[model samples]
Target: MGRTTIGKSNAKIILIGEHSVVFGQPAIALPLPSVTTTVVMSQTTHGQTLSSRYFDGPIVQMGQNLAGVAALIQALLTRFDAQDTFFHIAITSDLPAERGMGSSAAVAVAITRAMYAYFQRPLTRDLLLATVDIAEKITHGNPSGLDAATASSDVPIWFVPHQETLQIPFTLQGYLVIADSGIKGQTGRAVAAVARRKTAFAQETNAQISRLGQLSTAARQALATPDLPQLGHILNDAQQQLAGLGVSSTELNHLTQVALTAGAFGAKLTGGGMGGCLIALCPDRVTTEHVKNSLLAAGATDTWTEAFNLEEEHQ
Candidate 1:
């Protein structure tokens, strides 16, 4: 038996550039500490196993949805020369699954960090990201690695797949209202849907992708300039493109519209769309509350607020 080890990671949100990132487009994302995942690894009296709100079983018996996790555990054991060891990997997370909050990536990151700690081995940032991605590729086919990167970082970033992630300074004066639409955002299905669209309607789909990419770039500038209205417009435009790509669901659109009608400067689906949370950029605290109330009344299961400041303040 060995000492227990714990590893944890914060959730993340893509501010702009979602599906297009897979096609080499740039994206902006930031870590959200409001939600997180914690992994605990310890010597188990029983054989190798997993424990979480989602499942509890032998590692080998993990369902198809958790194949990435099982693969990560095996890979870690093999890499750290602990294949002969038997332990239980327990995951606790506040992040809502399939809400485009980087739950899978955060869990993978926590697991990798915990396993490395268990082995008393040094884990470099480069190795940590690569290790987490081994599972991300399985959970999210053709992932841009943005979620993994943001989950591990302390600041916002301008991310491009296969390129260096550039940290950005963010300190806007307002509130970012995030609301769950009471549905799972099927990222795999959304991604595959976009992929099919890209193949069948290359010109049209690529145009939408290109537009989203451009909006991400413009969004960066808007944030730098502290242009809240411009940022809101950019978000609205990006939502239109995402909807055009058929990733946005009726729930997502309705919630965003509700936020807008309730006096939000702008709002849009934040994650994989189809069925996930929407983010509303409110002009002030009062407007933020209005947006949140509207979302909840419109069937949002939950909501959180991240204030736009140099220091991340949660409400």
Candidate 2:
């Protein structure tokens, strides 16, 4: 029997820029350490098998939904020259799937790291990202690569597809409340809808995309000075642009409104929208609690709070 190897990755949320990032626009993504995915690997007498909440069986015969992971395992084995070896791969995650929390990317990153650890090999950041991108492609056709990049990183990231990822430095002084709407986000469908709209209204859609890109750029500057109000304003502007793109749903809008009414500095729908989570900026802990309670009262399925400080996050 071989020694067990483990790898872990945290989920992520898009603070600004979502569908627009697909068209060469910058976007910001924050790592969510509060949620995570873990992969464990161990040698086995039988062929390669997978154990997870979604499915459990030989890798070769996994369902279509798991094909990306199956291909990832195959690619890793080939990269390590261990195609003939046998192992059992087990996956566990706290991040909810289909909630626009980068669950798929987290899983891919964790599995890639575990495979490298199992082979007793060093994994570089570049290599890890490239490997994860392969899996991401299979899962999300023509992904922006933001999810994979953010999932593999700890700090907040500024990403533009096919460009070098920049780590934005900032001190967080307030609280962020994330509320899930209990509706699964249809990212593919949303992406398609945006594409159709872009084609139909080329000039208008391009203008909105350009505006979102600008907001992200400004938000990055605001983060440097740690301006919570400015950041909140940027979030609000981005949410309006997203709604114009037709990705925002009634539930998401309701949650954002509830948070804002409850004294949030700013509120917006995060991620792919159409059915996902909304994030609210609170000036302090007290406001965070108040806004959280309000969101629940307004029908939020779940709410989680994240407090950010430079000292704590950097350390």
Candidate 3:
């Protein structure tokens, strides 16, 4: 049989939701056009084994990520009755793991897509998303499923855990400067911290997360109306809530404030937060550059900006 190829899935940045999403709160997620992972499968002479290659450098393993991914693949193979199938799968991506980006989810989605194609099974977005969710559990223990959903679909989604999902309209189209801190934050550790805090202030924490979900819904309307100021306010509010969750670090807070002070419409830490990247909302390229420079000046180790065009679809 001929080699099977699948489309790549872009990495995601949780603009306004992270820890709160785990608590059944709503959050807005956007797909970045900058980084993506692809998987290609072909028959091999040897028995089943998965090989991976990163686009930038070596594939670094974190929190048993490699083993988890391998297990996911094995399960998929078993389900397809291709247990003994010999195939070679390669991956190339710019998304760095442990940087708060949806690196593992992207890998899972890409691999699942490739496997489905190889088996010549009817593929659906919903099925692929489900596979990614299971794969996520192996990495993060209890993921909110937002990462997998965003990575698999590439649409700007308003994710409310245990609630109906909404596709938010993009009103303010501009650039989003996403810069990494080069700091490694294990999702397991971050989740543990939140769990500890929950033990202390269970009701208060739950109430804050509930408010955050409501704010996220309001933010969606702001985005729909292209209200930059309102959107910025919502992001700032969400950041404060996440801070209460104990996910925001000193460095993350510093980065966010710097971006905001430098004219970024909105700024906050994305992902698990303890240490990762901060996203800055800008109205245009000029504002984005201004914020990017400010981020570097404010002790940001690495900073970059990406334009958010509504017409441009991420795959």
**For model 3, how does the per-residue alpha-carbon lDDT over 178-289 read when each residue is reduced to its tens digit?**
8776677655678788888788989988877788788878877887787888788888888888888888888889889988888888888888778888888887667887
Better of 2 and 3 by lDDT: 2
Candidate 2 lDDT, 1-315, residue by residue in tens: 578999999889998988888898988998877678999999988798999999998899899898789889999888889999989999999888888889999999999999999999999998998899888899987777778888888779999888858777778687788889889887788989999999999999999999999999998888778899999999999989999999999999888988989999889888888898889988887798899999998899888777777243311
Clashing pairs in 2: none
All models: lDDT? 0.88, 0.87, 0.77
Model 1 residue 290 distance off true place after TM-score fit, in angstroms: 1.9
**For each candidate, what TM-score against the reference?**
0.88, 0.92, 0.85
Top-scoring candidate (lDDT) = 1
* Backbone N/Cα/C clashes per model: 0, 0, 0
The true-versus-predicted C-alpha distance at residue 16 of model 3, in Å, is: 1.4
RMSD to the true structure for each prediction, in A, is: 2.6, 2.3, 3.7
In terms of TM-score, how similar is model 3 to the real structure?
Answer: 0.85
Model 1 agreement with the true structure over 64-175: per-residue lDDT tens digits: 9999999999999999878889898899998888788988999999999999998999999889999998899998776777788889877787987787698788756778
Model 1 lDDT at residue 41:
93
Collision pairs in model 3? none
Candidate number that wins on TM-score, 1 or 3? 1
Model 2 alpha-carbon drift over 4 Å, by segment:
310-315
lDDT of 2 at 190: 90
